[model samples]
Target chain A: MNFDEIYSSKLALVEDALKKLMERHKECPPTLFKAMNYSLFAGGKRIRPVLLLSAHELVGGNVEESMALACGLEMIHTYSLIHDDLPAMDDDDLRRGMPTNHKVFGEGMAILAGDALLNLAYEVFLENAMKYPYKLERHVRAAFVIARAAGLHGMIGGQVADLEQEGKDVQPDMLYYIHTHKTGALIEAAVRAGAILEPIEGDVEDAVAKYGQKLGLAFQIVDDILDVTGDAASMGKNPSRDEARKKPLFQLCMAWGNRGVWHGT
Target chain B: MNFDEIYSSKLALVEDALKKLMERHKECPPTLFKAMNYSLFAGGKRIRPVLLLSAHELVGGNVEESMALACGLEMIHTYSLIHDDLPAMDDDDLRRGMPTNHKVFGEGMAILAGDALLNLAYEVFLENAMKYPYKLERHVRAAFVIARAAGLHGMIGGQVADLEQEGKDVQPDMLYYIHTHKTGALIEAAVRAGAILEPIEGDVEDAVAKYGQKLGLAFQIVDDILDVTGDAASMGKNPSRDEARKKPLFQLCMAWGNRGVWHGT
Candidate 1:
C-alpha cells in the first residue's frame, strides 16, 4: 500500500466520523461547541485513529466495530493536544496553522473544550459498547486498555515527567521513559484495543504492541526532527519549537549521531 | 440518622477508599502523585460521595456495590477542584486549609495530577463494572450517566459559562443555568447513578433526579452564602473570593429577597 494514500484515506474516514460525532447540538453552548470544533477539525494526520482502524482491518476484525473506537482515540488525542498547548503548559499559539484552542477561545474555554472532549470520548465509546450484547467483553477489555493507557501510569505520568524534566533533564532512561509512557502507551493501546476487538493469540498481540512502541517513538522523534527542519507553511506550524524549549528528544539523538540513526540509538 | 453523623461516617469511608486508591505506585512520578494526594486528602465535606452512598442505600441497592462509584464521584469532584484552583482558572492559592495543588506542586504537575485523577476515575468505575458479570448493563448505564454529567452539556458547559459570565452582568436564568450545571450536574449524576444500580420505575428515577436538582441548587446557594458570610477559619479556604470575582449567585438572590428566602428566590 502507498502509505500516504492509506493515511489520507483513513484520515478522511476519521474526520468524517468525528464531524458526525461532534455535530453541534441545539442545547450545547455555541461558543463551547465552536472551540471544540475549532481544534478538533483543525486536522492532524489522525495517526492514533488510523492505527485503530488499520489494526482492526489487519486482524480481520470487523472494521465497523472499530469506528467509534477510532473516533474516540482521536478525540482523546485532540483533547491532549489542546491541554498540552495551554498557556500553563507549552503556551503554544499555533496548531495546524490555526490559533491554538486557548489562544482563539481564551484559556478558560480552551480548558473546558479539552475537558469536554475527554468526557465525550468516553461517552462515544461507552454508548457504542452498550450495543454489543454478545461481544461486550471485547468492548469492556478495549475500554479498559484504552483507559489504562490514558491514565496515571501512562500518558499523564509521562507528561508529568516530561514537564518536570524540561530544561533540566540529563538521563537516557528518563528520556526513554518519558517518550515511551507519554507517547508510546496510548499508541500501543490503539493497536492492542483494535486487535482485541475480536479474539487473537498472545504472540500476535505482543508483536503488535512491539510494533506500536517502535512506531510511537519513531513518530515522536520525527516530530522533533520536523520541528527543526520543516518550514511553517508546509508544516502548518512554526518550526524550531523543540530547540527553543530545549526539549530532550532531538538533542539526545544529535548527541548520539545523525538524526537518521535515532531509532538505533 | 443525624445527617452530620452519617456524613462523617460516609466521608470516612470515601476518604479511606480514596487513600487506598491514591496509594502511589513506585513507577508513577512522585511529585504527580504527591500533588494528587495533596488535593484529594485535603478533605472536603465529601458530599457527592455521601450522596451516592445514600442514594444507593435508599434504592435498596447493594451498598457495597456502590463504593467504587462513590470514590469515583469524589475523585471527579476533587479533580475539578484542582483545575478550578489553577492560575489560569480560579487562581486560588489555598484549598481546605492548605496550599492549593499548583501552589504546592507547581502548575504543570498540578494540571497533570488533575488529568490523572480524572482518567483514573473512569478506570476505577470501569474496573469495578467489569466485575459484575450479571449486571454489566447497570455498570455501562451508570458510566454513561456519569460521563454525560461531567461532559460539555453538564459541568464543563456550566464552567465555560461561569467563566465567561465573570465580571459581566447576567440574567437570573443564566445564573441558575451556571449553578445547576457547574455544581449540580455531577451531584445529580452521583445520586442518579447510585439509584440506578438496580431497576426502578420512571417516576422513581425522576423523583431522584428532581431531588438531586433541588439539592444541587441549594448546595451552591449555600456555598455562595458561606463564601460571603462564613469565616475563613471555619470554611477552610478564605471567604469572599467569589465576591472579588463578581460571580453571580448569592448576590442575585439577596438582590431579589432576604437571605432566608434564598430557595424560592
Candidate 2:
C-alpha cells in the first residue's frame, strides 16, 4: 500500500479499537458515557493516534502491540480539548462542528468527563501492559513518555503559559515555550513512544526524537496559520476566536515572519 | 510501635515524598506550580495514603517499594478535591480553612493544576515501577486497581451520579450507588492497591477488600454526619452547603434510619 492507503487502514483500525473501548464503558451513567462518546467520535482526523501507528510501523514494531498506546494517546488529546473548551478556559461553544462537551452536557459533567477520560486512558494503558507482562517494561517506558508529555512539563505546562500570555505581548522565547510544550510535546511523545515499542538501535531513537520534535512544531505552526487563513465551515471551529482573544499567533509575529527560516529554535 | 506511632511515621514520610515531588516541577510556570502546591499542601489529613501504607504493612509489602504509590494516591485525591471545588462543580470558596484553588489561582489555572497533578501522579507511578523492572507486573496490577477506582467505574462514575441526582428525591439504592462510587471507590482502591503490592495469600485479600469497603462507607457517613453535627470552624468549610444544595446525604434518608441494620448490599 502507498502512504494514503496505509494511513487510511491504520485510521480504520484505531476507530474500531476506540469504538470497542467506548462500548465497554457503556455501563457507566448514560450522560457521562454519552458526553465522552460524543467528543471521542466527533469528527477528529485521529492525527496523534495515526502518527503513533505510522511511526510504529516505520520502525518495524508490531502494530497490534501498540494499539492500546495509540488509542490512549487519542484519549489524552480528546480530554485536553474537552477541558480547553470549558468556560474557565477558552469557552469554546463549538468543536469539530458540534456543540462542545460543556455546551451539550453542562459544565460540571464536562469537567468530570474530561477527568474520567484521563483516568480511563491510564486505565487502558495499564490494563494492556498487564496483559503482556513480558513486554511490561516497554509498555511502562512508553506510558512514561506519554505521561510526561501530557503533564506539567508538556501539554498542561504549555496551556498554563498560553493562558497567562493571553492578550499580552509575548516574548519570542515564551511563544516557542507555549507552542512547543502545548502542541509539540504530545506529538513528540506519539512518535517516540511508537519507536520505543521496539528495542532501540544505535542513533535510531535519537533520530526519531528529533523527527518528532520538528514534526510537532511544524504541526502547531500550520494549525495557527489555519486559524488565520481558514474559514469556520472548513475548519469546523470558528477561525477568528484565537485572533479575537488576542492569542499569541505565529502569523502575527513580525520578527519571526521569515517563513522558511526557523529563528527561535 | 503502636498504631498511633506507625500512623504518624507513615504520614510524615508521605508528606515528605509529596513535597519533593512538587519541588521537582518548579521549572513549570510559577502560577501553575503554586496552584498545584497550594491544594496539595492544604491541611487535610492524609487518610488515603495512610490507609495504603497501613494495608501494605498488614500484607508485609515492602514499605520502601510502595512509597511512590502512596504519594501518587495523594495526588489523585488532591486533584479530585481541586476539580470538585471548581465553579462548574461544587463552587466552594474555601477548602481546609483557606481559599480554594480556583479562588486563589483563577479558574483556568486551577483546572490546569488539577490536570497537571493527575498526569504527574501517573508519571510518578510509572517512573517508580520502571525502576524495579522485576516487580513491574506487580506495579502494573496495583496501578490498574487505582486507575479503575478513579475512573468511570469508580470515583468519577459516582460523581456523575451525584451530579445528576442533586436536589432530586433519590432512592436508597441510588444513594448507595453514589456514595460507593464517589467516595468509597478511591478509599477501597487505596487498601487494595497496597495489598496488591505484595503477593496475595489465601483469604487475606478478600478480607482486606471487605474491610476497605465497610471502612470507606463508614468514613463517608461520618463525614456527612459531621456536616450536620459539627461547626464550620471545626470542619474548615461551610457545613450548610451540601444541605443547601440538597445533595443526597445519609443523614437525610429516613427509610434507612434503623442505625444498626445494613439496608443495601
- Residues B106-196 of candidate 2 have per-residue lDDT tens digits of 9999999999999999999999999888788988888889999999999999989988876677667787788788999999899988998
Q: List clashing residue pairs in candidate 1.
A: none
What would the C-alpha RMSD of candidate 1 be, to one decimal place?
3.6
Q: Report chain A TM-scores, every model.
A: 0.89, 0.92
Ten residues in sequence with the least summed lDDT for candidate 2 chain B:
B255-264
Candidate 2: which stretches are off by over 4 Å?
Answer: A240-265, B244-265
DockQ of each: 0.65, 0.87
Candidate 2 lDDT tens digits, A1-265: 8979987999999999999988887889999999999899997888889988878888898888899999999999999999998989988888899889999999999999999999999999999998777778989999999999999999999999988977677767687788889999999899999888888785888778777887877787777778778877888886746554345463435534543325433
DockQ, prediction 1: 0.65
Alpha-carbon TM-score of each model against the true structure = 0.91, 0.94
Candidate 2, true inter-chain contacts retained: 0.91
Clash totals for all candidate models: 0, 0
Candidate 2 pairs with clashing backbones: none
Worst 10 residues of 2 chain A by lDDT: A255-264
